[model samples]
Target: MDSTRTNKLLELLQTIGLQELNSSKLLSLVDEALIHVSAGRSKNFERLEFLGDAVLRLAATEFIDQQYPNLPVGRCSSLRAQLVSDRWLAQLGEQLQLESFLVLGPKALGDAAAQATLQADATEALIGAIYSGSGNNLEPIHHWLTPHWQQTTADVLARPHLFNGKTMLQEWSQAEGLGLPNYTTTEQSSRHGDPERFKSRVEVGSRLSANGFGRSRKEAEQNAATEAVQRLQDVGSEINSESPNNTPH
Candidate 1:
């Protein structure tokens, strides 16, 4: 990489609080990943991406464990999935405006829309690069990602009932012999990037279980399912409380 490019990358890293970096391994990988084409040199971030995928998962798990020692395995798994998901990574990459420094080839440069798998891949590769540079250490990764991780964990835990609502609701329905839940979505706004772009209603049996709004159809439906799951949990709790199974066996 050129001196100007190296300096720019360093500046970006510093902006995100990676102040005392020990390794340049991460930066090299970042450069490789951002450059869409490297004809002669095979220094792409693909390998780093593979390594980062595992490292990110491990570091996220460690973060969750330290923050929530009493949290169950199932719950931990759910939280970890969200933390390491492509959507989450892409969101972070976009927030940092990583694409502004990307060195894309002619074809890849044409479609400059900053969404989807590319940014996510880059983010993971970045983690891998950091890991490789830091001599397989996780301290720097944790330090850089701690704030984002905490916020993400908080947002997810706050909506604890919303975790995998669709799957949970489906299982609950099947167990209760109520068949599959039906969902209907309607577009509230046709404009681009509207938060309340779609509204969804979920039905169990002949009754409307719940309704929710989201940026996309899937999100709206999931939100509705979360509502249903919350209702179900409340009802179940109440039922158990009232059941008279003789006094404290």
Candidate 2:
């Protein structure tokens, strides 16, 4: 790579706390990672992104195992899912200001709808590049991602319902012999980044239902589930309040 490009990559590494690994091959991988397919390059980040997907999962699994050893397997699985989710990756990319580093084509630059996906893909590819660049060692990945994962873990734990509302609702329905919750989603808008782009309604058996809206179908469904869970909790509270345990005595 030329001096200017090398300097830019170095700056990016430094920004992400990876300044020590400054070799040419590593820089090349980083360069590839930041290149979108729309850039019309023969070599893009697709392969590295694929590798990064697995690497990210392994890293998340390890993080959960070490940090929350006593956590049940099901919870661990859910936590890892959040840690490696596309939404999480896109957020990370935004935090790192990765858009400035990306080399995009005119189409990609003009298309705002795909921006989040691009950021997510680029972030995953960057992780793969770091792993490959360091001789397949995961130490760098752990060092870089541990803090982020820790914060995310704490947040998820604090608002457990917000992070895994769908799962929690499903489990609640099954335990109550209510069968699985059913969800129906409809697209409400064609605008990218519209908070109410999709509307979702979730029903539990025949008596309980809630509606929610979000930028995507998954988010909309999750919101609906969250509301439904709240309604169920309210019903439980009401039943307890009406019980004869302490009636007017």
Candidate 3:
């Protein structure tokens, strides 16, 4: 690692109150974190984010399972999912000012909009780096991650249906052998009655599950998917329950 780069990273850690970190060890760890993207190699943090995401989920699940032995599997899974979400991870990254350390190409620079994704990815990479540096000492890593992890878990469990409707709907569908639920969409950019908005419908099976109006396709799709998940969960509960005849042997 370049001395200058190492010093910058040390300053970042110090800002985050990791003042206790030995200079030499912290430098080594920063070097390890950079390995996720390789030195001057990648434009996106996808690969590192992927590994970090798995690590976060697994670490979170292990923590919750050990701490709340009586919690149902569904809630445990929900908590894990919440902790590992882009939103929560991004928030944690922002708290650490993780974006300042990102390695991005010139074309990607000046994109403040990219901060959310970059922060989320950097957060994961940091977690992966910590885990790797700890010699798999999940105990220390768990402690480091616990504050944000618990906050996310608590928020999710407090309103389980809110953050997890999509996941629950997908799981329910798969468990019932419904095959993968497919989404079909139709959009109209201008409507006689609603001139300012674009209207879209998302359908599953023969049912028009959601209606959304947005100015763009991406926004419309997000809105439609959100509503579609809600609709599925609303109708899927009783239908998904196993009857004596259909119960597994």
Candidate 4:
């Protein structure tokens, strides 16, 4: 690690509200954080995103379980989905002005198409960084992520009958006794110089039902499953609602 670069990054940290970080720990933290953010096709964010996701779900689950004891399981899952989505996280990052603080490769910075996506990725990467740097300290991250979660939760709770794509997809498959929807990752690219992309397909009943793309495979799979559920449910609802006597007996 370069001392000068490390110093520069430490200085940058203060601008992002980490005024209490010490140089030595910041060195290790920033090094790990950068490596994690820039890993794979910069795929490191995926793991951090995964960790943060788990944390977010657990936190949301605990909150709902304790507070909304009368809420159904589906509603709890819907609330969790709204709170932990990438779109909401990206909004939180923007509120924190996170884009200005990102340390990206020159190429990544130069691309217009990738700029929007970097915010979401960087946010997840930062969450990952926080977990790594702070020893999985939920307090700081919760402080950071809670407002975003709150707004999203409020929006979702207003319409408790609605289901998120992930939840809907799972329920649709279960209703059919489809033996659980399966995900197959078709492509994952994280080359150092290339933009990262993940592609996946969701299958049900030996049928390739949907395809999706994302900066991470998890995101892609979620999208694919969501699409599959939308299609499946629409079809199922139509079939179920048909008049029984009008149908072939």
Candidate 5:
């Protein structure tokens, strides 16, 4: 790496709270992480992203185990899924302003719909770079990611349905012999990145249905499922309240 690019990489590390990091080898790894495949480089973020995927899962597992020791294994798995989700990684990239440092080809640069995916891939690669740069230590990864995980955990605990709505709804429907929830999605807008670009409707038998909107089809479907789950819960509450067992008798 040239002196100019090296200095820039150092600056980025500082921005990420990795201050006084002057190791050239680590800096090179970080540089590799920021390179997109479209850049036509012989080396890109692909390998690092793969490594980071594993590293991230392990780190998230450790975090959950340490923070919620009594949590059930199934719940721990669910929480880890959210923590290591591509959406979460993209959000992390946005927080770190990683787009500014990314090296993209003209095709990638002009593709707005793919921006979030690119960010997610690059962020995972960055995580891999950090872990590799630290001589395969988890300390730096934990030090950087623990706070984010804490905040995510709090949010998820407060509104658990929001994170795993589709799964929860599926389980509930099947358990009640209602079969699977059916989902139908439609594109609501042509503009990329629009929060309501897609609309989704979820139907469970003939008893319940809900609608939701989001930037992507999956998100819209999930949101619709979340609303459906909430409605089912409300109905159950009402049923229990009106039951003879809970009445004046």
Candidate 6:
């Protein structure tokens, strides 16, 4: 490992209130150019990326537990999904300029900044690297990520349906082997902020499951999706309660 590069990487950690026990390893995590796009580089962060995905989820879960101790498990899962989402991770990487530290192959370097997935994946790998460098001590990872999670959590909590409803609904549909839910909207009024300007209906297969009215088309769709998500949760809860695990002798 280059002493100067390792020192610089450690300094980067300090800026974010993180310390690394294995600076060299952490350096490789942010080196996404090599990990994702480099053809022949045997030394890459692909393994760390896998580890980071799990680490990120664990960190988000811990954050929810600490911040919303009274929140139900289902709601907590939703919040954790928001915090650890690709969009949120990409935003964090951009905020930290993680791409600047990348060691890219020629092909990956040209348009690196615009590749959101690359950025998000690199950030997760970096988290994994941080955990590794901390000798499996989670404190460094938590310290570094908690602030980001705090801000993200607040945003998601404020806009619950907007943040995760549609995405979760899609995932739920696929998981349930129902293909994809279809959403269609109709104009209800010729006005903005009318609270009934548009109405969106969500259909599962051929059945109309839920609908919602809102000021705008997007808002209406979000409202409809939110209703669907709530309905799915209710159904899931009912199923769980009826299961053997929840049955009372």
Using lDDT as the measure, the top candidate is 2
Worst 10 residues of 6 by lDDT: 239-248
How many clashes in candidate 6?
0
- The weakest ten consecutive residues by lDDT in model 5 span 240-249
How would you encode candidate 6's per-residue C-alpha lDDT over 1-249 as one tens digit per residue? 477756667666767876535455556554432255453577666888888999889888887777677777876776777788776787888887776666667666565334666677778888887777667778887788887777776666455545666766776677667888898999987743356678999887853378988756776887898788777666653111110111111
TM-scores, all candidates, are 0.70, 0.86, 0.63, 0.53, 0.82, 0.63
Q: In terms of lDDT, which candidate is stronger, 4 or 6?
A: 6
Residue 120 miss distance in model 3 (angstroms): 1.8
Q: Which sections of candidate 6 miss by over 4 Å?
A: 19-39, 111-114, 167-249
lDDT of 4 by residue, 1-249 (tens): 587766666665664556565456545555444432432343345566656566667666766665566666755665666666666666666776765555666666676556546666666666666656776666656655555565565555443223255555665567667767788875566642123377778888774389877666777787777677556556655212111111111
The candidate with the higher TM-score, 1 or 3, is 1
Off by over 4 Å in 1: 22-26, 37-41, 112-114, 161-163, 171-176, 180-249
Model 2: lDDT equals: 0.85
Q: After aligning candidate 3 to the native by TM-score, how far in Å is the CA of 136 from where it should be?
A: 2.7
Best by TM-score: 2
Instruction: Give the TM-score ranking, best first.
Output: 2, 5, 1, 6, 3, 4
Model with the higher TM-score, candidate 1 or 6: 1
Off by over 4 Å in 3: 1-4, 14-18, 23-25, 31-51, 110-113, 167-182, 185-249
For each candidate, C-alpha RMSD in Å? Answer: 7.4, 7.1, 8.5, 9.4, 6.8, 10.8
Candidate 2, residue 115: lDDT: 74
- Mind sharing the TM-score for model 2? 0.86
lDDT per residue (tens digit) for residues 57-150 in model 2: 9999998787777777876788888999888999999998889989999988897877777888999999999999999999999999999998
The whole-model lDDT of each prediction reads 0.73, 0.85, 0.59, 0.59, 0.84, 0.69
The global Cα lDDT (0 to 1) of model 5 is 0.84
Count of clashing residue pairs in every prediction = 0, 0, 0, 1, 0, 0
lDDT of 3 by residue, 182-201 (tens): 54445563432222245556
- Measured with C-alpha atoms, the lDDT of residue 26 in candidate 1 is 63
